[model samples]
Target: MTASAPQVPPRVRVSEASLNVLRSHTDQLTTAVNLHLEGTLPWYRQLTTDERASLRLIAQRGIMGLVNWLDNPQTRSLPLVNELLGSAPTDLMRSISLQRALQLIRTIVEAVEHRLPGLVPVGDQQGMLEAVLRYSREVAFAIADVYARAAESRGAWDSRLEALLVDAVLRGEASEQITSRASAVGWGSTCGVVVVVGPAPEQADAAFMSHLRRQCVRFAADAVVGVQGDRLVLLLGGVTDLDTGLERIMPSFGPGHVVYSRIEGSIDQAHRCAQAAYSGHAAAPAWTLAPNPVPADDLLPERALAGDDTARQMLRDAIFAPLAEAGNGLLETVTAYISAGHSLEGTARELYVHPNTVRYRLRRVTDITGWDPTEPRDAYVLQTALAVGRL
Candidate 1:
């Protein structure tokens, strides 16, 4: 069975003389609480003059609220106390932690309890003391509620800002506004940034997002997460080993190929990384046997086949241009090797050269382009680069 809510007690009935006495001593009580804070709390003395004045005003409000509650015990104290504390400056509320706030409440309670004998008739003093204790308890809960709401609001705002920053990076909008937004979300300037793209988990709720963030921190990296339709995009910074870090957080993604981009030197170049990663994710299905968590550059042939201009240009620059620049018939021999069904003797026959000469040129091609024409996969990439270069 569900538990019932606690019932609030009826308001205490104090005489008019006692209520007037409490009302007349509001300023005196406020000053007494401030003096007690200065003497008992070392941190209270460190506040600036304006902060101290703000605290004085908050304390006065609290005392005035307490007096009004004592006059009419039927009045609800929670909203009244919340309204009183809400008048405090936001910075002051943050500067005074929950523990410090509780201490401040204790100080006020003690100050009131000490003055009860002079403020009330002996017969009514006990009731007044009990009322003060009850009101202080309500004020404590109100303070906690206020801080909790503030924290939740801040978390929500940061999540939206983070999503916007990731979206900006994906769209290649590296403006000053992106930089400022990045800074606002605590994106560090550390180098070795990368973008990882994959299918988002089916249950991409707040708890899952929080777990994903914890995983990033576990690997000593800073990250921003964005969910676009079914895809999850993660921008990670300060990763020393991309492979190991991705491996650790692989479970955070859904069931699909997880593709990451090359390590960028800085965050400003993250857009380039994001472009490659996104292209790779789109083209990942073309290669059924490709490894999960594959590098975007490793999928250049597929990306090029998918009509990615950036991938086409990358292939031309990294493979074709270098081979063309390297002399000794390197480009011509590799072209003939691929065209001749990757047969060294056929390439030698086509070029009217010895097989050994064809072999030497193919080795040079491997050394220059880092793709061995002898390997079937590398052979396909070389063929694609050759075709893209001619275009």
Candidate 2:
């Protein structure tokens, strides 16, 4: 069963006599706040002259907000404080935290309450103290409301900035702007990174992103997730194992093709990795028997078939060039092995060598290209790489 929504706080009413007492001493209350801040808050002394002035202004506006809320007790307190604090410069909100702002409110409330006995009549003093407590509560809620809005605004802006950074990574655009943006989104320059691409879930929204972030935290990883068209791209960092990380995050994506790039040293080289994942994602359907979370390199045959030059060059460099460099008849042995229907004896016969020599050369082939000629899948990739390199 679903839970019920929280009820709103009840509005508090202020007595007419207390309201008059507060209105007459607005300047006194403001001065009291200033003196209390200087004596109690060491950080207040560290603020710039303009920042101090802004704080004083917010405090003064806060007093006026209380008076206004008192005048129209039935009106919402949120609008009352928001309207008052809205006049302060937006930058002030950044300089001050919610806890510090609440401290500021407490000081102002205490300063006002301290002077009540002097300004208010004896009969009205009790009423004045009660009004002060209620007014303080309302002010506290208003301050909380303002900060909540600011937090939401900051979160939205960060999400957009992160999306732009991911876009730059995918498009292979290396610029100072990309670096600056990556830093802004907390992407460490030296962290190991990988890019995962797949179709996005249907209801991709703030809640979904929050869930994805929580998953990252659970796995001790950092990520920037973006939805470009139907594709959801996640740039994961601090991951020591791409395959392990993929296993944990696989449930976050919709079914279809999910491809992860090999771990890269830094985000700067992430674009190269992202390109491979992007190309592989497009070509993944061709590999009907592909694993759920397939490595981008595993799709090299499909990528090469789709005319991706990057994939073609990757195949040539990773497979063909290594064998060619080893020389020692390794290249011919590979060709002959596949041509001999992966028969060790047949390749030995074709190369006019002992069967053991063919076995040793096949082991050397595995060491050179990290692919086993005996495995059907590895043999297919090797055959494709040789064909692509020759073309």
Candidate 3:
């Protein structure tokens, strides 16, 4: 069965109650826009029925938040619109009213037709200046009010929404709706998705975010964008792991060690995939994304650790297997050997052992694992495996 249709909100109730405070502001806006347009508007001017309904639905979504903020002490100052406006906004804006709001619109249109110096005049030229200042202040506050409510809303519901959005996307049905939804949720047009595991920001601090964005850009020059969360899902449509890719980008990200997940498709799709790649249970790689259906191997802490864990079943066979078999400190010796790039002199200096002793242990590793350091390639592979295993 088809899902039930969304409830249609009554304009009267919305304008008078939840949207009451915004009513006067809306009236003011209507007057301002009309004056600029001239007095040719028909009576009963309002958003087209469809636009009205859409705006109302959007407003109601916002109002639910306003109601919650009113109840919250930490967020009490959040709804300034209610204090500035009211629950019973005047009907002056309704076309049937033909009232003060309409009068203001008429006045501005007349002034414009008469070639008034500016858009709207308050009274005398002095009033005009004052009106200009007052109008500007009101408009500025209104913009700030919208953002305040938005930021508050994001804090309360974004995690759930992000998850929902991701599901909708993965289903392959909401591609067109994605951008609009992202904007509604406060993901700015110019943004990035970072996948970090150590910590996620409780609040996206302006300077910290700027630093992150700036650092990412410095490396790629608009090559990357991100959305912050448990995984810093990133969209790297602009950079790749080509010879100069990392060279052209990624210098500013001071080296604690990080990997850029690869993505394919439009920047927007890249944005989504970046989240998916990082969101999955693995550590990202320090290389380019290989292609569609991305690798099944997720970079995880357990897999990246520094030992041969693939055959743990053999452990009890030797009562700790290699651990017991090594007898003293073979793991430590091998670790040092790997870190020193399998150089006998370096491992000896680090371990305070004779270089000959380092060689003997290296030979022993070959005996146990059937992998030998005598071949330089095997040594490199083992070292990388060990590093990830440790991670």
Model 1 has an lDDT value of 0.83
Model 2 agreement with the true structure over 28-128: per-residue lDDT tens digits? 88888899888888888889988888988887887777778666666577776657667663645767888888887788778777877888678777766
Off by over 4 Å in 1: 1-16, 71-78, 89-91, 114-118, 332-360
What does candidate 3's lDDT look like per residue over 160-204, in tens digits? 454444444434445567655555544543433332222334444
Clashing pairs in 2: none
Regions of model 2 farther than 4 Å from truth: 1-20, 89-92, 217-222, 240-244, 263-265
TM-score of each: 0.85, 0.87, 0.34
- Cα error, candidate 1, residue 109 (Å): 3.1
TM-score of 3: 0.34
* Of candidates 3 and 2, the better by lDDT: 2
Model 3: runs farther than 4 Å from truth?
A: 1-35, 38-132, 148-255, 260-391
